[model samples]
Structures are given as C-alpha cells and as structure tokens.
Target: MKLLFIRVSLFGILLFNGFSLKAQQVKPDDKYNRREEMITMRDGIKLHTVIFSPKGQTEKLPFLILRTPYGVNEYPSPEKQGYVKDMADDGYIFVFQDIRGRYLSEGKYAMMRFSRDKSNAKAIDEASDTYDTIDWLLKNIPDNNGRAGMYGISYDGWTTIIAALDPHPALKAVSEQATPSDMFMNDDLHHNGAFRLSYAFEYAFMEEISKTDSLYQFGNYDTYDWYLKLGPLSNMNKKYIHGKLPSWNDFTIHPNYDAYWKKQALKSRLDYPRLAIQHVSGWWDQEDMVGPQDAYKALEKKDTKNQNFIVLGPWRHGGWAGGDGRSLGNIKFEEPTATYFRKEIQAKWFAWYLKDKGDGKFAEVISFQTGSNKWKNYSAWPPKDVATKNIYFHSNGKLSFDKPSAKEAKPFDSYVSDPAKPVPYRARPIEETYGPGSRWYTWLTDDQRFVDSRPDVLTWKTDTLTQDVTITGDVIAKLYAATTGSDADWVVKLIDVYPENYKKEPKMSGYQLMIADDVFRGRFRKSFSTPEAITPNKVEVYTIDLHAADHVFKKGHKIMVQVQSTWFPIIDRNPQKYVPNIFEAKESDYQPATQKVYHSAQFASSIELPVAE
Candidate 1:
C-alpha cells in the first residue's frame, strides 16, 4: 500500500517534469538515444536495465542510475527517462533498472535484503548486485565518464542506500530519499512496535500474495467499518490471506524486535564515508519520515569527510518530487517549495557532484519551518545551540511549562480504552489505503479536531501565547501511564491550534493541526526484543519518539497535546490483554482496559522539545 503511493508519486514527478520541459520549449534532441539491456550480477542474475545517452557527443559524460522494484517502465518515454528534463542540457547518461525478481529480473525477491558477508562467494545482496551493475556500466556503456551517481525515492531510495554501503569505484554521489531505515521500529511496518494494520496487511496482500504491483480490492468503501468488523488480526489469514502472504506469515511468527527484524535494519551499517550522500525527506511525510533522518544521524557518527547531508520539507511522502508544495490539507506553506527543491536544491546537488559545474556549497542540514513558511539551514542537525524544554500536562485540560504546585490534589487523569470502540486514526468512513479516494497518503496533516471531542481522547492545551514559540528538533513524549489489562498501546499527538479569528475558512477557527505524533506498545517498554506483561495498575514511563520537526506556534495560537490508546484501522487494536503474538490473538483476547495517566510532581508527564534560542 505504501509502495503504491510511492509509485504514483514518482509518476507524478515524471509528468510534472515532462510538462515543465515542454512548456519551456525543450525538445528531445536527435543526439540522444535510448537502449535496453540485461545487466548481469555476480551471481548470474540478470536485471532489466535501460540506458539513455548522447549519441554523437565526442566528450564522455557522467552516468546517473536509479534502481527500483517498481519496474523500469515507470516512465516509458525516452524523453522522460530520468525525470530530470530540466537538467537535460547538463548532459549525462541516465540509467534505470528493474530490481531483481521484481519485473523482468531473475532470482527470488526478498524484502529489505540483509547485507551479506562479502567473503561468501555465493552471497548476493542488493549491495553486491549494485556493485556488479555499476562495474558493467562503466566498462560497457559508450562515452561515459569514469564517475557515476545514484538517486531514488521510497523503495528505490532503499536500494540507493544499500548500493552506497559497498559502493564501486565508479559510484561517487548518492541521494536516498525517504529510505526505510528500520521497518519494525519506525518506517512502514510498525511504529514503536505497534503494527500498521491497513498499510502492512494490504501491502503484503499486493506484493506477496497477489504477486503483482496492483491494489487489492476491498468489498466495502469505508475501510474503517471493514477493518473494525474484521475483528482480530488473526482473521486476516482466516478470511482472505489463508496463509499465502509470506510477509504476513513472517509478521505473525516474529512479533517482537527479534533477530529477523534486527538483521533487516540499515542504520547500524550506514558508516560508509567514501561516497557523498544526501538524505531527503518531508517533515510531514506520511511514510518513512524516520528513515532518512535516522540514516543521516547514523552516518554522521562516522562522516570523516562530512559528506552526509539532510533536507526536510513541508511535504508529504515524496511530495517534494512533484506538486506545487504550497500546502497540504488546509495549511499553506506560502511558497512553491517543490519547485525550489527540484530546480535549485536537487538539480544543483547532482550538477555539482556529477558534473563539477558549481562551487558545491550545501548546508549540513536544510529544513523547512511549517508555520513560519521558510527554509532554514543549519551547520548541524538539532542545532548544538538549542535548549531542551519540557511542557507539562496539567489538570482541567490545561498545559503549562511551569511545574504543577504540590498543593494540587488531583494529579492524574483516567480514560477507558475499549477495544471494540477503538478511535479511528482519521475521521469516520476511512478510505482504503491503496485504492481510489484513499486519504491514507495525507492523513498525518488532517485537522485533529475530529477526535479532540471524543471522551476516550484526553487533550491538553496551553493558553494563547503572547509571543511565537518555535520548536526545532526531535519531540519526545514522556508518559507515566497505567492500564488495567496486561497489555496496552499509547498514542500521543502534538498539534497547533489556530486562532478563531482566522478567515481562511469557518472551520479553520481553532483548527488543531497535528505537528507530530506516534504510538508505543506497552509490552515493549522494557525491551523491544523481549516482551513483558504489564503489572496491572502500575505506573510506568513510556517514551514515545514522535520523530523530528521544525515548527512555530504563532502568537495568539495554542500548543495542544492529545493522548489516546487506540488509533484504529491504521494501527491494529492491542486487545488490551497479554498475547504471545498479536497476529494470532483470538476474539477472546480482546477486552476493554481502564487506562490512567499520572501528571503529578513525583511523576511529571511531559513532552520534551528542542527549542532554539
């Protein structure tokens, strides 16, 4: 399901670039030619690859490659080969390849293939396959410069990072956009051990079960009702999958952060410093936002040459790849951020590295401020000059930075988390994740007011600020909570409350715009790899990483926090009871639990924000 959105996004980029090129009267030059061939890997597996180059040029040009599992026919037209028609005048050979076992390639397909031991002769991973392909291209491709560059988004982005792990001599600069760093920890599969139900299930059905790059049809249009009635996670197989999806089977067998999932993580191995790397992602990216950020942080530890950089925008998943990028949902960014990124940032990065055409001055970290609608460059991420501030949750639905007085009596709040009445991640009548009219792509930025009034959701907000308050780094929610059941799930949302006098729309008044949010499964609090039953009625600290962000809470605006147990249809219900494997839990395991959140001076439940001076 997530991959489908990525494919659509890439296609949109091609169309956008194609139209922009035509608008500028750029025509396909007769000097350029296109050809298709099968690139053989070290293990003799052949991958379908296409090459586009200048036909009659005497000077050799650099080669840029994009390897993807979404098939090489994504563009179809030779003019739209690289989706960089704007940079066609710079002159470089563009190469696109279908990953092994995806389309016209050979060998078995494995999701997030673990890096193999290079000493083993028969071991073939994406890194080895990429090294072989680059070696072949440098030797066989005509009129090619000694250097090569690799870049891609989403799944292809993952391949780009993998290729950089053990790059060939010819591989120089790499840009990995929205790369999935750790599926179980953050990315598409789960969020803090909470399984992404709609995304993971449908994605497995499409990629593993159907064996095709197509969306699975759901009988009902309202996926909210459909998934709710589906009952337990176990019914996915009993009703439709029938033990067919290998991914789903794996999900059930390894419910914890065991060796199987740990091996698939890429962050631990992102220490290569030989290649110049640029990590790109959106702050509001519906998928894989943590991937690029985490990958950059990991590489920074060993960035001897200071070659790793990060770029974050106010776009959704792959949103910077196309569109005007002026706004998402109702909020406006007040600029053509997408255009600036594509032309000034992205194209310039490639031109400087691949062509050596410019001074190559790029920031270590470039991020956009959402509320303020401006781009800011930093010498380092989470800027070293920032101060950490904790916002406490207070009584009577109030939020404050000051510590609660010891005189206060009621220092805790409680709510009922009913499994049968789980709160929807978005508004009611939720659309399918991958099909027509699906709102899954932009649900992150949806106005959060819908769930604010629900009794099960506890919301706290600060008084209208007299001055703007800006937060500029990672956001962490430190919650002291207890559940009556043996297992539980906690969801925390950071939102920006609009001023009531705003004239954009009547509904815009007091609109709660979600800034950052994430979920944490209680069983994995002690250790992700090991699960422990929650001692009922015991207050435990659960730290939920809402990832990174740069946003401003305007004067007269309010900073809001909403906490809940269940974000249904999106994340599978926890059953609120101890279960060995959620995917195997029965209907009998589903039970309601009373949840408590303590905000006393002893146990100050608060959100830590990195605030710049």
Candidate 2:
C-alpha cells in the first residue's frame, strides 16, 4: 500500500498556460477564483482543500502546502496548476490537499496511517492531519503570510514528512521528494526482507483493488508472463485479490518485520528542530531510495540547527518533476538537471525559507555525480573526506582492491539457483509496472547487458581502471554465502564497465552501468523482525546495502560485481525451503538451491567502497 506513483507531468499540468515573467496572473476578477475547501480535521475529519490566491498581489503571501493522498481533483484548472510553475515567481499561497481518505477526503482510509493513540486525545496522524491543515490555513486563508511550506513527490513525499511532525507555528519549509521512510525496511513493500512481488501485485491492483483508480487489467502483455502465471504469494489471496485487498490483507498478514511493520516507521519520528528540511533523493530512485536517506539520517540525529538538508539527484521516480533532468535511461547528466533543480534548486528553496527571499544557503550535501557528470557539494553525507575501500573477491574471475590472498586456490563461486528457472528482473517482454510501454520508469538505468549472459549469474570484474575512481558514500554488500536450500534470495549488483573505444556516444561503448543494487532476504539474514533458516551448508554472511552512490569510475572504466539468485517477477520467489509463511508457501515450496560465493582467506567477500578521492 505504499505506492505513491505520480510521475508528475499531468499532461504538462494540463497544457502550460504561459505566464512566466516572474509569474503573476490571476486577476480578471480573480479568474474563476478557485477555492474548494473542507479543512476541519482535529478529529471531525474533513480535509479536501484547494485554495490558490495571487490576484493583484499586494504582499502577504507564503503558504505553499501540498499534502495529498493523490487527488486534489487533478487541478481542476487554476490553469491546471503546472505543478507549481517553477514556484510561481516566488509568491505563493498555493495549498492543495486530499489526505484523509482517497479522494475528496473525509476519513477512514488507513494504510501506513499509524498514530493510534499517541497518548490519545482523539489522535489521528499524518501528523495530526498536518496540524489540522496548518490550523486551517492560518485562520481561513486571506492574504496569508503567516509562513508555511511543505513539498511532495512520492505520496506527496509522504505528506511532506507528515507535515514536519508537530509543526504549524505556521509550518515553515519542508521538502520530501521520493519519500517512504520505511515500508518494512526499504520502501514500496519490503526490500531487505524481500517480497516486492511485482511491486506488491501491481501496486495492490492499482491502489487497493481497483476502487476506480484504474490500471489492473493484464490478461497478458507479458508482466513477465503475468507475474509468472500469478502463482503463489498464495495466488494473491487465492486467485486475484479475493479479500478485496486491505493492502493485500496487510501483505498476507504481515509476513515479518513485526509490530505491524514497526509502527509504520517515520524514522523514529524525525525530531523536528523547528522544522525546515530538504531531503529529496534519487540516485536512480526506482522507488524511495531508502526514504530520503532514512529521513536525512533521522534528522541528522536530531539536527542541532543545520535544519537538515540533502539532495542527491540523477533522476527517476518523480525524476525531478518532469524531465530535462538531462538524461536517464542512457545516462547523460550533461546539465539541465531538471532545469537546474527547478531554477536554481527548488526555486531558491522556497525563496529562502518561505520568502525572506534568496540567501538561505544550501549544500549540506547536494550530490549528483554519476560517471563524473559533475555537481558535487557535500559537507557531510558520507563525505567526511571518505575512504573505506574494500572491493575484493578473487581467484579466476577477479575484482580486487587487494585482500583475499592466503595463496588463493579456488575459493568459491558456484551457481544453480533455479526456482523453476528464475532470474529475470528485466529483459523479456516485461512491460506494465504501470501502463504504456513501461520499462517501469526506466528500470534503474537498464543495461547490465541484460543480466550479462546469465548462467545463473555471478560475474566479478576489474582491470582497466587506471585512474579516476571517486565513489563517494555508502554501498556495503559484504557476502560470504552458501545455500543448498533453506530459503534464499541475494541479488547484489554494482556494475559500471563502459569503455570500449568510447567516444561520447558510440552506443555507450560496452556499457554495463548499474552502479549499485540490492536485495537480501535469505530469511531476513538474522532479523528483520526475525526469520532465520539456512543451515543447509552453512557459510552465511550476507551484508547487502548497495544503496548510496555518487559514482565516477572513468578512465577506461571496469568495476563490475553481479552475484545472483532469482530477481524474477521483481523479487518474490524465495521458496528455497524454509517457510514459516512465505505468504503461505506451497507449490512444493519451490526448489533447487546450491549457491556458494565465498572467496576465502577465511571467507572474504567484499564491496564496501565510499572512496572519494
């Protein structure tokens, strides 16, 4: 139920109604003065707002809100709100809501709701409905300069981090973009504990069993053979969502990470320091890249004052609000980075904290470094003058920053996985992760030579890199593996390769380019709310985080890594053996195992990386 898939371009916000000379066009008696309203929510629940305001602008302006459970009636036409026409020339009163139910809000629609009695006073969440919609827009709208700000992207970026947790002193500044602080460990329906079965069954049949939000059809356009013949995850409630999806019956009754998914993790309630955050992410954000870097490291461990910041781009998932992010699926970043972050970083970050105008100063970490395409900044995010390194894994199909020696003699690297022939996270007829020739929003920059001649995959590479390495932050992977069956699913990628008489384009030379990947679920490898099993042939280690990255590689690039075990039907088919409830296993709990992977001097698998030099 965590699918906030709004890729922006609402038909280019209903055909761009031109007005950009620092924008200001609404009068003609306030051109159809768009207001809408419902508001209310201190427990009487109403919330469905819209607002707009600008007319002859005499000053008192600053509201920006956004909240959203996805429908503010699709901008009925305040000139179809071009998704904030680049922050409408620094004057804002905008608003727009919904968040309470699915559409014209009211109440009773809880999925990731969680506020069940936080010391009850009729407690309702999404941060008290964003502090009662910023106390009814600073007491019923009208020339509002009472300061308020909020931003969104994915699930309206989780309703702008639940409206900065307990904010409203007239809320003040926030930006979440691609949010999902934790849907069971990563985002959009489990990652570390696996189970992302075709994005939790076509995003629970397009948001809870087609209650009209459409797109569930697939009688066949190869969603990899309709999720491999929709087999088991208990045939999605015994053949096509029969329980009428209460979030797929809470994903077949919470398959692990307990306390109902750790009370819907908002990353330990992001300690708001008088709010003001930025947090947007996307280093190929195929979905909440660990929710705005774990809510900016849990608000930088209670951000003492730096008002938490982070930006990370190199687009995908709300790809910086509609293109010109200058290259993605073929990787280019030659500027235009989403029109320079919507004109110099999110319109000068809400015109410097909701309009004191400009100089609010940025860069706590503003990343965007894919293959040396520039834009760096960094004062923190994994950049304490980095250097962790590691790399390793040798004997025959090398890849080494050195380690693994003890006179190497065939360490380990077998294969065989076979859950009835799996491993195809891509390349097949594939489509439909949501309509129209979908490469599911740029399959995280495809080209890993489509699973590099998969013989049950397991690559490892190196040699060719003579200079520029420059990694820059987080990417673990570790792994010391073994798996004759007892449950498995490992994945791990990290590629790069490129260079083969490479001239600017020549079809990207040899191209492998993945740059980071993950997937772990071997019985949650020791606890994602406990699951454990593999003793079959022992050897377990399995770290896997492959998350953060800034990239660079270059100078005759090479760097590869791979290692597989079924990424099929997009992760969901780990029935190697053990089953407490892999959504009620069965179908002979799938089979075939024999995985291996070591690289000894006492099992040393490796990846680490941070580097930056």
- How many residue pairs clash in all the candidates, one count each? 0, 0
Show the colliding residue pairs in model 1. Answer: none
**lDDT per residue as tens, model 2, 140-198:** 87777788888888777887887687777878788888888888778788788788888
Q: How does model 1 fare in lDDT?
A: 0.82
Q: How well does candidate 1 score on lDDT at residue 23?
A: 17
Look at candidate 2 and give me any clashing residue pairs. none
User: lDDT score, residue 375, model 2?
Assistant: 89
Best-matching candidate per lDDT: 1
Per-candidate local distance difference test = 0.82, 0.78
Measured against the true structure, the TM-scores of the candidates, in listed sequence, are 0.94, 0.38
Quote the lDDT for 90 in model 2. 51
